[model samples]
Target: MIPKVPSSPQAISKALHSQRSKTFNAFYASIRSLRQTPVEPVDPPSPADNDFILSILRANPSLRDTRSYLASFGVQPQRPKTKSEAQLPEIVIPPPPLPKTSPSLGKVSTEEQHAPSPVIHSILNPVYKRTALVKIQGPFTDVQLDSITRGLAYLEKLGMVSVIVVESDDVPKGDLEERQLLIDEVMRVVTSLERQGSHARPIVGAVVRLGPKPGAEESNTDPTFITPETHIFPSDLTQIRSSLRAGEIPVVAPFALDSFCRSVRVDANDAIAGLACGMVEAGSDNPSEDIDLTPLRLMIINKRGGVPSYARSGYPHLLINLDQEYHHILDTFDPRWKESHPHSFSDLALARTCLQYMPPSSSAIMVSHKSPSSLIGNLITNKPAVSSSLPHALLQGNLRLTPHTPTLLRRGLPIQVIRSLADIDQVKMTTLLEQSFNRKLDQEAFYGRLERTLDFVIIAGDYAGTAIVTNEGNPGSPDPISYLDKFAVLPSHQGDGTVDFLWVALHDESYGLGHPFSANPNGGKGGKGEGRDLVWRSRANNPVNKWYFERSTGHLRMGDWVLFWSDAEKRLKIEETRRGGAGLSFIENWESGRLGNWAQVIPKIPSSWK
Candidate 1:
């Protein structure tokens, strides 16, 4: 007979949280052990407790490797008992070898061309895979279930997956009988192709819990029964990887805590995280292995897959690169961040560098927070050629806020702020401009003008738009000014508030550098008494002038362009010093810094651009 069920999704969420917390705690502990830097302070040893366990540890010797609770706070390994042992220096275990890499994606051997293919590891290659992790999410209707099955079948076909692990713990709030049904349904769909005579081996291993015989709970008075904790069996992962290597899929239904003595409550995420940490530990020990032990990526699929909880626009996702910051990211979500367990999606996405995990070079993971339908094409589509396979395309639009609002961004988009021309790779920046303008920029001249020293570069929407702000004067100059060298919004997003946002953000950013005659102590750092007006130029015929006039203090048509400045000031004695002679040389000198003639390449004043 079936047990009771939760009536709503909220009820299921609560039940899932309670059951998974224990497992998650354990997984978190395991990750902390492998982290390079301690996430939290290690408590000092307790005097009395240390003496008691240290003595036992000293007597039993080999018991050191087995027990979880011993002299955890105080005991150090017992000193050598024999003379030879005492004479030995501290034994240093060398690190494991790194993974072997090929120049590109080349064959291990020409003769075994038909062998199951795995992604080739590329060292120093920015876009190649070092590992891949898969996360299968649930809560599907019959139709969605069919789509999921097809997606899995596609993976089985491409040989992209090493193994697919679906355990009872992964199923939402349900009884043992319901959990079994869930497992069976997943296996049948995944292995449907096997019945069609396909070479794929979808269901090869089933790991179910055993033992903890009745009355075992009565015999054991473990504290865990009161407050459950995460527990991962080494055998589970060992068996899972083995099955995959032998071309079999493993579905693990881990035993609930040994303390519970019941065949209920499974935490799949706890197990998955445990497996990831284990592989990291093992791979660290043997980096130069002929065979890869861990999957390159470990994905966690739930309601929204890998999408963030909130976004300012549609098409939001975060493709996190877990290289150096994985531990930091894990730490935030690891209970220690706020000293609480992660119970919701917001807590899970806890890091603000976007955390980088310890996958080998060129390896990265993408947490897709969208729907399962998105995964369908990514899994089944033919492996497309690299980026160079296509011609370059034009890009425009810019988003840069001084005090970064990290949460406001879409997923998988990485942003960098360049403070100076030296901070950028000129060749690359020039290419970006070429695309934005749809006309090639003079590379040498662009680089030379960049010596004016850019103050900041804000690229948002993944280089779709950018603003190049430059520092334009010597401190001793009569009029020191900050110039907006280039500001372009893509034709597509011209009036979408991108320009307005930048204008306000840049103004505030400049104001914060300190202003002339302002009592706000923090306001006027730009060069007190030197200048307060921020200036730039636009084409005289450009329609954007209408909008510029509305915002600027004043504008003067100087030949091809109109010189615009914030209304905070009239003429500056210092600006006149810019060229000694008249005829708008200051404006003309400012315009000379850019490559490609502005009049020839710039867009006409569209209503929206204004």
Candidate 2:
């Protein structure tokens, strides 16, 4: 009475027998391997095999229930099959007898037994409960969904409560089936973790999209989402404020600071302070200001080579040049110097004195000057002159002063002028001179003159020569000749008894007998040579000079005067003379220790007169 079968009974029976034989063979092989090796292999099932098995089970309706299939195969059910079987008393077998144990392998010491397992606790664990609003813009594929699920699983392992906030906009249009598949995968992962006692909470929620307002494009419209758990709303301000108040640790994300600040309704300063505090707490040594803008003073002394010649010379000519140019510009701008001639000198002297006494700052630098004219041109152009052009080391030459002969100018003695009181000290003077000169000089010569004279030493260029006073005298001595001896030159006119004339003139001026030299003509010589000559002659017959000479009679030996005159003649011959009185007349007698009348001799003017 059974309905006519589509296939013959014999054919169906044969097919079933073949299927059963194949299943038995597979099971028998597996059982044999397990029996042979008690320890099971740790390898996971191949992905292909797993997929195939899953596909077969899904396709076969009867095999969908794995428990029924296992029962048919005579496999013991996880739970007792019948009530009678479950109610039966369980029979427990005795364990095998223990063998004699070796002390080293079988017996563990108390210390070893009590020792803790080397299990590492992860700091990344979500110790603090926090809810983050993650807005995922996507039409994710199955693989992508799986990846996201895996990531959530990792978070769950670390004790995090993860929830997926799903929005309709996130699903692809006309892909409802695929979207469902994604949801199913997510649900699967959550279910699997829950069954395994993991706290993986996957949530599904929708985001409400507001239509664009006014002329804005629809794409530009933003969607708002809700998160009820942890009370962490998606509003940027709320999140930031909460983070600040709670002292929540900031996630390491590349978020825009300005945007973040605007969203949080917090000032940048507050954020910065918080960040600084956090950094310090985290053991960072840097200050907040430093981190914001780490400043460094980079001074690059641009030398031709890494090691400049000026540096080797121990003079910073480049620095000096720049300083001098600055001073010159200042002088030009200063109204006081322009209005009064005497005031200008006083100002210059004061400046020089200040420079002489003061020590250089720690950051002083030295450089070389190869182009002298270019440097001077820059100065004239009101541009800052570099020290490299006038290296101070070049000032180490001898500075010689010859009286009144303009031809001796080639000797370069007149150009040796010092600008400061520090210029009086040999070491400082030489350094300054070398800077001005931009060339290396004889250090011994320069330093010796500096110590010996204590008078300002003159600076000279590389090709430009130098001279030193040959006479020896104590520092600060009042003798005019002694004082003059400190300088490279003395101004004396040969047969005119110019020394006597200068002495008389100086005395007269000091006593308010003679007028001061008419305001220096032609703005004075601008450079070293012109300046030196002007200063020498201007002061030679100065009242101060006369007073110094007259008052210093005891120190002024006749030999000193005679030596002064002799040296003066060697450098500059007597060219012409105008008799003030009988020539060679004894104006004063040293042995008598009194002012005495003298016999007059004829004045002798040299043939080399102009």
Best by lDDT: 1
Candidate that would win on TM-score: 1
The reply for model 1, stretches above 4 Å from the true place, is 1-132, 141-143, 167-179, 189-235, 254-264, 284-291, 302-315, 318-452, 457-610
What is the C-alpha lDDT profile of model 1 across 69-171, one tens digit per residue?
1221112344335788678797775422222324453434533333211111110111211233443445444555454444443333333443344433335
Q: What are the Cα lDDT values of the candidates?
A: 0.38, 0.25
Lowest lDDT block of 10, candidate 2 = 404-413
User: Cα RMSD to native, each candidate?
Assistant: 23.5, 38.6
Q: At residue 404, what lDDT does model 2 achieve?
A: 10
Q: For residues 1-610, could you state the per-residue lDDT of candidate 2 as single tens digits?
A: 1112225556445433443223222322232232221221122223322322232322222111222222222212243347787888987854222223244445544553333111111111112232222112123444443443333333322222232332223334456464464455445544544443344433222111112112323333323211111111123233332332343212211112231232212211122222222222222222221111110100111111011111223211122211222243233333432342222222222222222212111011111112212211111111112212111112222121011100000001112334344544455444443553345667665444545444333333321222233223322433322123222112111111112222222222121111122111112223112111111211233333432332232222222121111112111112113333434333322223211110000011111111
Per-prediction backbone clash count: 47, 31
